[model samples]
Target: MPERKILAIIQARMGSTRLPGKILADIGGKPMLCRVVERARRAACLDGVLVATTTRAEDDAVEWLCRERGYVCTRGHPTDVLDRYYQAARQAAADVVVRLTADCPMIDPAVIDQVVGAFLAADPPVDFAANRLPDDRTFPIGLDTEVCTFAALARAWSEAGEPYQREHVMPYLYEAPGRFRIFLVRSARDHSHLRWTVDTAEDLELARRIYAHFGGRDDFTWGEVLALVEREPSLAAINAHVQQRTLGDQA
Candidate 1:
């Protein structure tokens, strides 16, 4: 058998319905997308990192940023994120793919490594892996991780044709539990309540508050975010109801 190559592909775009150009928005000193890519690099299991972005003209700036930073970039259809991922993975020649979203600047590298490790540590075989697909887990939103074989991805690409499936991608694999072996990462509910994802002005304010609490530090972990949220409960109250409450439903 051939050795599996793990690739982390971050999906980003210049247009965000809730927070326009949020990826390029400044968090601390650097753009939020750059922060996310840098954090994804810290995952010990990821063999490579690529930013999968949209082909829209607005995304040209994202491409420029990638080139300037010496990071690999791939562009594909904006709406069909599943297709974008498939194209990016094909270009990167990845055997195993990890999905990350650019809106998550405060993502924890430790959590990324743990989820990746769990997939690799699975008994016989792990066809797919994610930290918070079912949503019962208390992990922070920005701290999501997914590991899937190229074969499985190809299967999803060919078989998962629903609009929601194409938009979010990989939902079918998780719904059909018996089809793929999935590894879930469940740690204490430390940062689970922390609003790290940026979707609206409130979410942006929440992220800014987190950076302020941590003094604009990029090395901060979800544990640190949790500690701060515990100390200042008001900060955690920011946009607490933003993430869909239905996300709590798990299989």
Candidate 2:
């Protein structure tokens, strides 16, 4: 609606070191990737949402799921995810690209709109904007959203040399301060300690519990989930000990 085509490209696959086949994992009554797409579609900022899987044989199921649901999906290198994003953006003719991961089934549409709105509202416009980053992050883990221009994404895809940069996607945009115009969107309340992402067994357990609490409804906002976790402290305790993984640790 802003004259530019905004597409949220979700990088997904059947392989995950921590939780293999997690894209298709059940969180509530539906597959987690489907849940992510459904929630993303609710965001008013996005023109469309596309899933970018890999060419690996294992990811055929991912393509199948996308097809069965009538979602547009693109296949690319398994590890070079930056390339996958660039190709997906180019193919979709996306002027603005929002990057999301499939592991986050509870991704908030409000949060997506918030970040995308900020990205679009920037006076001079930033090369990239994100709700969470390495040093400054106040939002919960699973609600993370990163928005960048297709040109910015293409630059990163062409220039990023580090494997971690490629695998994590968007690191090249923010890893260097002056190299690209970067903006940070922080929440008023610091909820960085909250781990809502599904990357481990504990994280998955917590996701199922949260979804179950909402009666398998994907319309719940991040605020409601925060309140639910506050009222029921036991729910937060479920994954309190699970440390959020960092690219530095793996790199």
The 10-residue segment with the lowest total lDDT in model 2: 242-251
After superposing candidate 2 on the true structure, give the runs of residues whose Cα lies further than 4 Å from its correct spot: 248-251
TM-score of candidate 1 relative to the true fold: 0.92
Output the number of the TM-score-best candidate.
2
lDDT of 2: 0.91
lDDT (Cα, tens digit) per residue for candidate 1, span 87-112: 88988889988888898888778887
Per-model root-mean-square deviation over C-alphas: 3.0, 1.5
Give the alpha carbon lDDT tens digit for every residue of 86-155 in model 2: 9889988999999999989889999999999999899888889999889889999999999999999999
Task: Give the lDDT of residue 15 in candidate 1.
Answer: 83
TM-score of each: 0.92, 0.97
CA lDDT of each prediction against the hidden true structure: 0.81, 0.91
